[model samples]
Target: MNAGLNDLQAMHLRRLLEGGLPLDARPYRRLAEQVGASEAQVLEQIQRWQDEGLFRRVGLVLKHRALGFRANAMLVLDIPDAQVDEVGRRLGQAAGVNLCYQRPRRLPQWPYNLFCMVHGREREQVCQLIAALLAANGLDEVPHQLLFSTRAFKQCGGRYAPPPAKEVANG
Candidate 1:
């Protein structure tokens, strides 16, 4: 198993990743001070974390939907188990498909294993892209759903703060 983070490092990562990044020209300096580390040390540690798979991204979360994007849909695909990998890659490459991921299939009722997001200027445009994906992949008959957003409540990054471990008692 991969080694877990130590206390200080975990705390620093939690603050830096979950808590908002310092909004300054010398943000690293401010962040280091807050985390009780030197500026150079913070930068180095962030670079190291990037090298490791601890983080795929460390940046600002912009509000794309609020920025005049009229169409946004969460598309779930019920692809065959064997073809999931291939279809996921193709869906990821599809135009306007900003995000694509594989999820566990819930049998009978919930059959979708692939989920992706599509954003566009208009509903028609988004539908057209989805149609293109269906035709291009010869998956017109594949079970799927396009969940268009009626009201976007919250679109933000995941919370990176480490959850407090449960207390354990020994007999």
Candidate 2:
């Protein structure tokens, strides 16, 4: 819990945050209005929560399909454990690579441990970008596979607090 914030105040603020910060010039001020706090107070509380490790980051969740980025691919690489981190860093910084992360490889079936997401307006463009990235990163010899997205899925930011329960009408 943040200092000077009661449980109710914290819960209310959290619920508002779960919905995402308002799209206003002074978003914190808007939030302050909703939570009945000063703009500075709201900012301070958010900083305190971050310092306490309550959340890793507040970032944008892009809707690639809506943006006309029709071709999307998840490039999974079979990078050796010792080199995964260094290679992932290089690939992650390459142009056209939107996202990159490391995951554990499942033996026999799923051998790839590193993943990268690349998006573009066309399949050929995405593939060419991936090829250039591989060559630039010296990963041409690395075993990998590109899984192109076939269907769109709903995307949204994280939600921490469960929704408030609705009241039932009594007969």
Candidate 3:
């Protein structure tokens, strides 16, 4: 729905891109064929979309359980407000942590603020990594809790759509 892109072309582009590029030497060429566009045009359009801020970084989403990473835990730390940023940076940079972030504490109950996720084939391995990370980051004494994954869930990319076209009577 970006300006200047036709409805049909936009739908085709979305349909093709959502499923991901085909595994081929010339994926752009294949995409172009599927979308009825030149390979260079396809690439150029994508770059244009990115430049226009309509796109974030293109990345892969992996299924940890399928990859044998059966153990996963989300660690929440009660970091002081003054030190949260520095601690978060250290946690984010640590090797074992897949994701690190800071969030506000829910007062009167939940005191934890910072969070990070660690995944491994074994819970012990994850625990070891977390221990090393904590000792290295000087957060060994920080109040923290670990929430483990208890069930499997389906995974898929989000779907997006433009507003529906307005209906008009043809006289």
Candidate 4:
């Protein structure tokens, strides 16, 4: 909401973003056309918003199943608190690791503090890849589990802007 952007333009841009960027070679140009502004202006406004902390990032949500990646697994590890950060960084950079993150260990039942995702065309392939990742990271003896996804779930990016207000009927 900078001075450079009017309320109407901001609303229009947010509504368009809610559905995701247009699938075109020049998506920015398309967005500029919709907002009646130059592509550079639109990009500059987006950068300003980002700098003001309106949104931290914009990223892709891949449809792995559609790409023929049938096997997906969450590899959870029970790394010691002291070494969790180091281990997580190493695994995050390794191949075959789609995503990596750390979470609090829910003791007495769940003890995993680190998690990474691996995907492949088959369960066996995923398992082998996970094994290689662990071995390469020198975590051969770490306590872990490979929880393969049993079903595909909908995936999408974050939506921040609210829907447009409904127009009232005239008396």
Candidate 5:
């Protein structure tokens, strides 16, 4: 409903999402049932939304801290423009480096562009792995920061509601 979706369509999607997907093999089918559509209809709409760049991702979010991977470190690298994509790919592919991406650099204050999240049972282990990754990738000369989260924050799925149809037409 935030962008490409109309009010009714987004409402249906939100209705299904708010209840969370069923764990069965036919989860989409179940979603369709709850949202008043067929399985294929739901799939096609979701695919169309994705193709239109409505959202970057749609998937499950795990609670790593509850799973014993307590140490969560966000590693930001000041990688050169030429190396950012390559380094981000490598980091994303590496074990324990779950999240990796390249963001715009903020000049005169922050210069980091490549970012990754590494998790481990212990903080020291996470640090050691980062060192290993830097050495292995020959990124020792690159400036970086490893910011370990001191506490867990409230985590939840995004919430949204579609605007009235009249507003959509008038605006």
Candidate 6:
């Protein structure tokens, strides 16, 4: 359990993530000024939070789609319930399989339980990789489907404000 942060520190933490880190040589110093703390104090609090697992990581998340990953697909697998975990683990370790997860298998009509993502230079290449995975996993007999991404409407960080209506009206 993390030690409870006072309201001010909590607000500062949210602002830091939502607005992003300062683009300066010494971001800690800049952030300290913005949040009304010494750089050393800010560093100490952040380090403590990290040590306590309150925050997992603080780093850049590159936009893969914007970086020429034009072809992307979500591959769903219909593995036996008993084998889903093993199959998911194997698929997750495979190169090009960026995301692998397990979802409930809808019976009768739907059977896919394992899902994985593949992003590549071309749709053909992504399909080939999926075929290879099915073969390597001895899942040629299993049912599956590949759902390719058609469009991306919005992609951004988490919500920081308490909802525009509430915040604006209260302010």
Query: Which structure among the candidates has the greatest TM-score?
Result: 2
lDDT of 1: 0.81
Off by over 4 Å in 6: 1-5, 18-24, 55-59, 157-171
Writing each residue's lDDT as its tens digit, candidate 3 over 1-171 gives 324445576577776777666889998889878767777777778887899997776766678889999899999999989999998998898888888998889986999999999999999998888888888888899999888888877665555755445799999
Give one digit per residue, the lDDT tens place, for model 2 in 1-171. Answer: 334656666778899998888999999899888888778778888888999999887888888899999999999999999999999888888888888999998999999999999999999999999998888888899999999999986777777786776899999
TM-score for every candidate vs. truth? 0.82, 0.85, 0.76, 0.83, 0.73, 0.75
Model 4 regions more than 4 Å off: 1-3, 50-58, 166-171
Arranged by lDDT with the best first, the candidates are 2, 4, 3, 1, 5, 6
Give lDDT for model 2.
0.88
| Clash numbers, per candidate | 0, 0, 0, 0, 0, 0
Residue 13 displacement in candidate 2 (angstroms): 2.2
- Give the runs in model 3 whose Cα sits over 4 Å from its true position: 1-8, 11-19, 54-56, 157-171
lDDT of each: 0.81, 0.88, 0.82, 0.88, 0.81, 0.80
Candidate 3 similarity to native, TM-score: 0.76
lDDT of 3 at 78: 98
Model 1 ranges with Cα > 4 A deviation: 1-6, 163-171
lDDT of 4: 0.88
Order of models, best TM-score first: 2, 4, 1, 3, 6, 5
Residues 69-162 of candidate 6 have per-residue lDDT tens digits of 8788999888888888888999999988987999997788888889998898789999999999899989888989999998877665665544
Better of 2 and 4 by TM-score: 2
Estimate the Cα RMSD of every predicted model relative to the unseen true structure.
5.4, 2.7, 4.4, 3.0, 5.9, 4.1
Give lDDT: candidate 3, residue 156. 56
